[model samples]
Target chain A: MDVVVDNLGVFGRGLLVSIQISAATFVLAGLLGVLLTVCRISPVLPLRLAATGYVELVRSLPLLVLLTLFVFGLPEIGLIGPLLWTAVAAMSLYWATFFSETLRAGVRGVPLGQIEAARAIGCTFGQVLTQVVLPQAVRTSIQPLASLLIAVILNSSLAAAVGVTQELTGQTQLLDQRYAQPLVTFGAAAACYVALAFVIGRSAGILDRRLAVQR
Target chain B: MTVTTEAPVQRRPLTVRLGSIGQQDAALFDVPGPQAQRRIAIATALSSLALLALVALAVRQFAINGQLEWDKWQLFTQWPVLRYLAIGLLATLQVTVVSGALALPLGALLALARLSRSPLLNRPAALYIEVLRAIPLLLLIYAFLLGLPTTGLRIPLFWQLIIPIVLTNSAVLAEIFRSAVKALPQGQTEAALAVGMGYWQTMRLVVLPQAIRMAAPALVSQVIRLLKDSTLGYVVSYLELLYSAKVLGEFNHTIIQSYVVVAVVFVIANLTLAAVAGQVERRFVGRAHRT
Candidate 1:
């Protein structure tokens, strides 16, 4: 317990890095997700096929393998970047597929009648999409997106494997190695993660309730 | 309470939405007019060219890195190398199977306890499920890996990996089971009780069978997750596919090729599992509609 107290600054900074990675991934992946979702539902055959294939392929592979590939494989192709950015890039690429799926599901949840009603009211394709589809999709996706954010935070720990040791899990491992207090260090780290997850989940719940469309 | 006589609405299988673009696409867009068709055709051509260029760029990089060399991949063609990877795959499957077998039953019990009328059973079950679900599986694995050794418990490498996976997945599986149970019509249980059956008996005979069928696809999806989690066996140096690939990569000096091959193997295995899950879901949906 004293070990954790003595290293409070270390844990706090590590937690901050984890949050930064998760935030970066959420924004980047969310944007890419919207693009993929658009392509997936678009009329262009090749774009649809390409987007679908990417999502399916990425979804099947493990995040750790993907991380190792980016960390080791990308340099051979002359695309080296900072380790932190590499981890973020890999995570965004991976989670974008999931984000697209959730967004697609959210679009699916939009009633067919609403789209028809919008079209009947002389709304163009762009207007119908931007006005009718996106708003409701955003509302329906809040909970799943919250869950994905939590997943991103949890998965950011994988960065440690690829030598990004500034995050909570990696720093905990460092402390454990230095002090041999795995229970104290790891227990504190777990508490931080659980607390973050709880906060995200509860906030999302409140947001969902506030934005829920009354039938 | 009124005993409703309506046929249960056919809920679309989650796999259909997940695995493919469903009929919802038609609702999302209008059928193309001639002008729209021509625009789509041009867009398709442009996208195809873009995709082809991306592929060419990737191939060029591989060629430049000498990663496309026959010498690099030739190691995989040999019998010994194949056997070594096969052994690693066997170990991966062993961990998945053992952990999955333990997790499914334990998860079912947790779900049952959570759904029980007594707070004594349900409260602790809820806590276990929520806490486990929130924490990353890697952390749990680390706990076992680092924490156990400190207490003078020198367990085998296999158990170290398997124990944490079981702990984490059982919680997720419990949630899956609980949702499937809750989705059932309350009438089914009431009917069973009315027919002179006790609560546990109704659950055992009437509720669980259908819940399992309903949950089959989701359960298979969880199996895919379990398979992916087995790759974490690498962290413990457990001779799983990823770890073996790393070892073989180092020995053969073909790190990139080795990881790529193992990744392909994982993708193929997972895709096959996903297809099976879709099939199970279709069968269940068909059965449900017929009844």
Candidate 2:
């Protein structure tokens, strides 16, 4: 208890890094997700095949393996340098796969007639996509996207494997090492994580309500 | 609620939009047109260009390194720890399979409970879903792994992490399924009840079949999640595949190769499960369509 209280700032910094990683990954992956979802149903056989293959690849592997690869492998080949990039890239890759699926579901929900109506109004392909397709897709998908972001937040703990110092999970270990009481340190960390989760979940509910009212 | 004798109105067919189906498809590589030979020539040129680029990169890497390092892949096949990795991977599979099996029944129970007419059961089910939906899985993992042991419950290391995972996962899946079950027309249950069927009998013989069919895709996805969540066992110090990869990286200084192999293994395991899920979904959908 004394150790956790003493090292509160250190632990708070780790929690912030986790939030930063998850926030960035959520935004980037959401966009990438829509793109891949479009690709999955692409009229082009090769494109559809490639998109399917990519999603399959992402879903199968453990996040720990992927993160380990980023930290240990990319630097060896001169692809990455700083340790945070490793965590960010791996987190983005993992979340993007999930976000893509959710985005695809959103895309699938958009009525076929709405899209046709937009094109008949002489909208360009890009305009129709940006104005008509994506707008509604995003609306229908907020709930699922919220869920995926929560997952991104959770999986950020895996980044500890790649030497991203001071994550919620990692700091627990740190406190355990210094304080020699895994019980108190880990329990405190667990409570913090759950509290964060409760907030995210409630925020998502408020978003869901706002969207419903707008509709 | 009035039955209509009038035939449905038929609308004219509308143009197919690009997002729905691009005039060519998303990225459009198919050229099965009359100018087939010309298209083939373009495709062939593109392939050769890509091949050349890959070879050039390999050549540069080989010249710089004096070898492709391709021979180093043998670490996967011929290591003293290879057996341990296999054991760890099997443990990973066992955990995933067992957790999923446990989750399915519990998920169904909670889903059914949510649908119960009694407010006591339904409201608590709602609360459970709300709480589990909000929290991250890692928090649950920490709770089961670290918190439970402190309580002197004394669970095995393997089951320690697995319990929280199953609990949380089943809760979400319960929501997925309950939503699907509730989405159906109320007339199905009404019809059964009007025919003097008990609530349990109606649920057992009627509601479940339809709900399961509708929830096929989600069920498949939850299974994939279980497979991935099995890796979180590493955080709890359980010897899953990812933990084994970490061990190899820490020991051999060959972290890249070891982790890549684990990634490939993960991809393979996921793809295999996905394939099975696909087959099951198709079978169920096909039967639904027929009936």
Candidates in order have lDDT scores of 0.90, 0.75
- Tell me the TM-score of each prediction against the true structure: 0.93, 0.79
Return the DockQ of model 2. Answer: 0.41
lDDT of model 2 at position B95: 90
Badly placed stretches (over 4 Å) of model 2 are: A1-12, A34-52, A78-80, A173-215, B1-67, B79-84, B117-120, B288-291
DockQ (Cα-based) for each candidate: 0.53, 0.41
A-chain TM-score, model 2: 0.86
- lDDT tens digits, residue span B81-171, model 1: 9999999998988988899999999999999999999999999999999888888888777778888888999999999999999998999
lDDT of 2 by residue, B1-291 (tens): 999999889754553332243233332122256686566557556655765687698567534643337555667677677887898889898999899899988998888888899999989987787667655676566556655655577878878877888888889889889988888789999999999999999998888889888888988788787888888877777889888887876677666677777888888888888888899888889989999
Q: Candidate 2's residue-wise lDDT over A1-215, tens digit each? A: 78778888977887888788888877877777777776676444344545666787876777776777777776655565768766787778777788877877777677777777777787777787788877787788878877677778877777775577567777676666566666677667666766777787688888777766353
Model 1: runs farther than 4 Å from truth?
B1-24, B281-291
Task: Give every candidate's TM-score on chain A.
Answer: 0.98, 0.86
Clashing pairs in 1: none
User: lDDT (0-100) at residue A77 of candidate 1?
Assistant: 64
